[model samples]
Target: MQLKGKRVLITGGTRGIGRCMIQELIDQGVSHIGIIARDKKSLKELSEGYPEVKFIRIAGDVANIDILREAAARIEDKWGYLDVLINNAGIVSAGPTEELLDEDIYDQVAVNYTAILLLTKYCIPLLKNAEESAILNISSGLGLIGMPFYSVYGSTKAAVRQFSDSMRRELAPFNISVTCSFPTATDTDMMQKFEGVEMDTPEYVAKKSIEGLVNKELHVIFGGEQRIKDVEMNFSDPKKFDAQVAKTYDQFKQSSEGHKAM
Candidate 1:
């Protein structure tokens, strides 16, 4: 859908891909935008930085249902219709699943999965009212294949992938498009804990996201060469895929053992 003068709402709009998406939307002539994130100050900064646009900042943790519902209500009250809903907020708790903190598990599921579902549920009417509308879900490449030390994150993204697929079919009759993005490891604060992993800049993801949405592409997979390889491996050979994942686990175990020895 063309972004000119579109009413767009993006979760986690302060940083990473969300920030870049906001900028890209501005470039595409989006006038009214709503941002949902945890920090009020950051929201203010973004709003001030974009004086040419109308930015509505609803500051709250997306993991809280009340907070998300409140934000949705504000959007409904203000515009009464939504042209785009970008479900981009997510958290990552990398490492062995058993070793993850209890709070981490809860936050991952709530912020990444549940929040998106409920927010979409709340915004469906607004979306349907628009002449042309779309919902963009930010998933991950890891969601396409189970990987070592990223089980929880991967699972949540996988859920998003499935959700997007189902929503696409369901919303087809309503003329609402659903697009899911599967970006590889992106150079965001979320990926900072990983010591030596190469990542795509958030700019790349932002560019691809807008392009995919305009084209109404079903899935936008970033990370050129490695992304293609991963998709091919998983789709073509399940045994090889499993073995590759097993090797990654072995390497991670060896690394942990060496760290303990040191």
Candidate 2:
């Protein structure tokens, strides 16, 4: 779908990939862009920088269905229709599943999966009003393959992948495209939480996201060969994929410790 003059809403737009996407949308001639984030200071800064772009900042937890519905109401009030809904808000908690707490699992599922679902549910009506509309869900490569120390996080992303697929088929008749983006570790503050891990920059993801949106691509797998290999391995053998991931996790753990020491 053409982004020019499109009314776009992006969750978690205060920083990282979401922030990059907002700038990219502006570059693509999007005149109205609404950003939902919890940081008022960052929202104020963004509003100051891009005064021409319609920047609406809603500060609240995306996990709260009521909050999301309220945000949707506000969007409906400001703009009668939404051309794009970018479900970019997500969170990660890494640790062995056996050692992971209930809160960790709950937080990841709530933020990564539940929030996206709820937001999409509320935005569908607004999207239906537009001539062309799309929903872009930000998943992860780990979603396709279970990774050690990231069981909860991976599970949530996997759920998003499946949800996107089903929603795409359901929304096809309405011409509202559904796209799922799977980017490998990205160079954001989230990546800093994991030491010594080579990650793609948010700029890379932002560019790919724009490309995918323009092309109306159903699925996007970023991070090049490694990401492709992960998909291949998972399709080849689930058990083998898990075993390989376990081995890689050991190496990553060791590297993380070394980096912490230095």
Q: What TM-score fits each model?
A: 0.93, 0.94
Tens-place lDDT digits, model 1, residues 121-240 = 999999998999999999998788777777777899999999999999999999999999999878887766555567789998999998898789999988787768978989999789
**lDDT scores of the candidates, listed in order:** 0.87, 0.84
For candidate 2, lDDT tens digit of each residue in 1-262?
A: 7888999999998789999998888999999887788778988899789988887788788877877998799889999889999999888767656766688678888989999988999999999999989999999987987766777788999999999999999999999999999988788877665776678889889889878987899899987787687688789877887777676777765543311100
Off by over 4 Å in 2: 254-262
CA lDDT of 101 in candidate 2?
67
Backbone clashes under 3 angstroms, per model: 0, 0
On lDDT, the candidate that comes out on top is 1
lDDT of 2 at 161: 95
